[model samples]
Target: MKNIKFLIAGILFGIILSKTQVVSWYRIYEMFKFQSFHMYGVIGSAVLIGIVIIQLFKKGIIKDYLGNQINVKDKKKGFIRTLVGGSIFGLGWALSGACPGPMYVLIGQGALSVIIVLFGAMIGAFIYGVLSKKLPN
Candidate 1:
């Protein structure tokens, strides 16, 4: 029953993403290019709502997922690490015109060319996993 609920939730999310056109590469590219605010607006609104919820729940005022309290801890990384990671991520997004989520959507939409991006993503993830222990925590 839990697995069925999870599957149904995933399907519902995919349907909503498709219906909202949020999975469109053109929409993502437009947001990246700053030619359209639609995608950013949606994301920003989500962030805002999340922030409000977290704040209200932080005092043990609300239950969390699985009825546990959120840790409310901030994980800090070095500035250099943040800059380097952001630059690499931005370059990939710019080049592909699709972020990870949209890349999967593109594949589902029958864009065979997206396989190259997916392959690269998989390789990148593998390399990251291999190097992760060597990198600072």
Candidate 2:
């Protein structure tokens, strides 16, 4: 019941991603190669929208879908951790031509090949979960 709405929304999002060719591996490759601006435009638009949404949430100008107040908190900055994590993420995306979000969308679009990437992601997450307590905050 309540979760059905999210399921529908996810389906809609997947459709949009497919129609826009945002889930295409070639587009992602082009983005990394600087041979096309199409994916950059898409990413920039998303970032702008995210900034606006975050600002609205922080200002109490908008609430979540369920009507709860949105609280934006600033976490302690970890520059080294951020740099290392981002580097690893970028390397993985470059190698796989897909990030986690688009990986699922690609799977939804019948890209069974992306299952390997998803499996690796799950393994990485499991390792992180197992070692998080021993890692830095």
Candidate 3:
């Protein structure tokens, strides 16, 4: 019952993404090629919103649904690790035209092709899980 709110929010978010063409492979491709500002604008706005939300959390201005204190951990700056991880993520996004969340939305919108991307993502996650202990922190 209480989870209905989350479902509604998810639906709204998917609708917005679909309407804004954020789920479109063409838009993603244009962004990657620097041929369009549409995707970059959307991503920039999201990053700004995220920064604001994180700052609010850090200042204790917002609480969880249960009203508990929310703690934002400071991430360690590791240039090499971040470079490697970001490169892998960017490569996957460039190839698939959608990240994980948007991949689900694309599937819901009847894009069956994204299922292959989702399957590959699942396999990658499984491999990461298997190799996590052997990999660096």
Candidate 4:
């Protein structure tokens, strides 16, 4: 029953993402190039809402997300790791013209070419998983 509910929710979410025109490569490209603010506008609004919700929950006005208290904790990492990881992620986003979240949407919309991007992303994740322990703090 839980899996069924999750599957239905996922399907609905994918449909909405597609209907919003967020799954298109052209739209993603425009966002990365700053030629369009459509996607960013949505992202900005979501961030604002998230901040408000988090603040309210922190104040004990609202219990949410399974009643677990939320706290902001910065990851400890060296400057080099941060810089290198960010650069790589940015390069991939620029080259693919799609951020990670939208990549799944693109795939759902029949963009088989995204498989290559997915492969690269998986490899990058694997590398990070392997090297995270050895990376300087």
- After superposition on all C-alphas, the RMSD of every candidate to the true structure, in Å, is 2.5, 1.4, 1.2, 2.7
Worst 10 residues of 2 by lDDT: 101-110
Best by TM-score: 3
* Deviation (Å) of 83 in candidate 1: 1.4
Ranking by TM-score: 3, 2, 1, 4
User: Which tens-of-lDDT digit does each residue in 1-137 have in candidate 1?
Assistant: 75787778767866777777787778878888899989888889879998988887787778765798766876685988788778988898878877677676677778889999989988988998999789875
Please report the TM-score between candidate 2 and the true structure.
Answer: 0.91
Task: Return the TM-score for each candidate structure.
Answer: 0.78, 0.91, 0.94, 0.77
Model 1 residue 63 CA deviation (Å) reads 5.0
- How does model 3 fare in lDDT? 0.92
Winner of 1 and 3 under TM-score? 3
Tens digit of per-residue lDDT, candidate 4, span 7-74: 88778877877887777778778888899999898779879998998778768777744686666554
Model 3 worst lDDT window (10 residues): 128-137
Error (Å) of candidate 3 at residue 44 is 0.8
Write model 3 residue lDDT over 1-137, tens digit each, in one string. Answer: 98998999999999999999999999999999999999989999999999999999899999887898799999978888799888988999999899887998999989999999999999988998898789776
Can you write out model 2's per-residue Cα lDDT over 1-137, one digit (the tens) per residue?
97998999988988888888888999998999999999999989999999999999999989999899978998779999899889988998999988888889988778899999999999988988898889796
User: Of the candidates shown, which would achieve the greatest lDDT relative to the real structure?
Assistant: 3
Name model 1 segments beyond 4 Å from true.
53-65, 70-72
